[model samples]
Target: MTNYNELTVPEATLIQKQLRDNIKVTPYNGPLNYIAGADISFNKFSTTVYAGIVVLEFPSLKPVGYSLVKKEVLFPYVPGFLAFREVPALMDAWTQLPVKPDILVVDGHGIAHPRRMGIATHFGVLTQQPTIGSAKKKLFGNYEEPGPEKGNYSPLTDRQGELLGYALRSKNKVKPIFVSPGHLVDVPGSLDILLRCIKGYRLPEPTRLAHNAVNQFRLNEISEGWTSLL
Candidate 1:
């Protein structure tokens, strides 16, 4: 794993630039039976990362199997450098899964970042798996508001006017979520999968479940007197 703390500013910038320059924005046509989501929660004493994989009956979006892992954190949070703090533990959790997932839905940014290498991108590159970023808020990008109806979406472009992804409305009147390509998937393809995964919810089922799982784990840890770091 690349250590963010050890890299010089120039080196980090170069690495990020390389990542963006080499990013592949293409449609994915491989098997997508198993889709997974990963998330993390931090405490003053530790961080808990969770990854949940669900096998859907291709195009039907049904659950088959799921798994999660939690570990004590050893790194601190840093903005625009979050992959370093979170990806390690998330990788550990991912490796524990009995079956490899076809698509990974991470609860963070992908190309919609200052470096275009968010948690989803980093994990996808490391695992060499197709992944999508479904974030609850915009990390970087500009777009007009989507329609109030479900399934409506608007483009989310970066400062340089590059098409990053889409801000999609999964439910009527609910806040839209940002969808972006992580790896092996284009912006439109990412949005398509996100829409398929939404079963009348604000977020996709896999991501929503993973978020809930991590938050619940963190809440339990806090109830047990663990101090929160983030």
Candidate 2:
């Protein structure tokens, strides 16, 4: 078990090193009948966090199961150690999921980080599930701009020229998203999944739905609390 509370930056870095070794980048030939997306959002002007998981039936991309959990922020926001700040709350929501997804898509980076371990990797390792990192921005690495067409991609490479992920064009004439294997999945698999999940949006359906879910939940909670106080 990994410690999730009261750790220094050095300790966190050490843990990341151990967790990075456990990540497996391979193709998942198993049936992906169900896919899920996990994401977290913070309350406005507060440290309270809402984590959400949205499951969608694969190929068809229909909604199946969803879960959300709220937690007081425990860890501070650190540049490379975002997992510590967010994963705990995400786990709270993940445990409430009734249907375990065949693969997970996280709204963050994977190996495309300074430490080769990101929030997506942490979630995948803890859950022991195949996970993909589909990030809105590039956290690290350099890559040429992908072609201005949906499904086109360019390799994202580290300073050492090792390929870490891809800059994927999910929509035509739009900025690309960064993608990498979190665990139990490879670059090719990641690309395939992302392209399938995209439905004419900058983000995939699973993640976009989850993002909406958590935000709506937060709004409802805050509104209800305010009304009760009136």
lDDT top scorer? 2
Q: For residues 1-230, write the lDDT of model 2, one tens digit per residue.
A: 45566889999999999888888888889898989888888766788988888888899888776787788876788888899988988887777776688998998998788988988888898889898998999999999999998989999999999988999999999999999989898878888887899999999998898898788878874321101111
How big is the positional error of residue 212 in model 1, measured in Å on the Cα after superposition? 2.6
Residue-level lDDT of model 1, residues 1-230, one tens digit each, is 67654665567667777666667768999877778777776665545444333334446666555455565544556666677767777777777666677888988888888878977887787788888999989988899999999999999998778899999998999999999999889989999888889988898988876676667666663222112121
Give per-model TM-scores: 0.84, 0.92
The Cα error of candidate 2 at residue 25, in Å, is: 0.7
Model number with the top TM-score: 2
Off by over 4 Å in 2: 1-3, 221-230
Residue 117 CA displacement from its true place in model 2, Å: 0.6
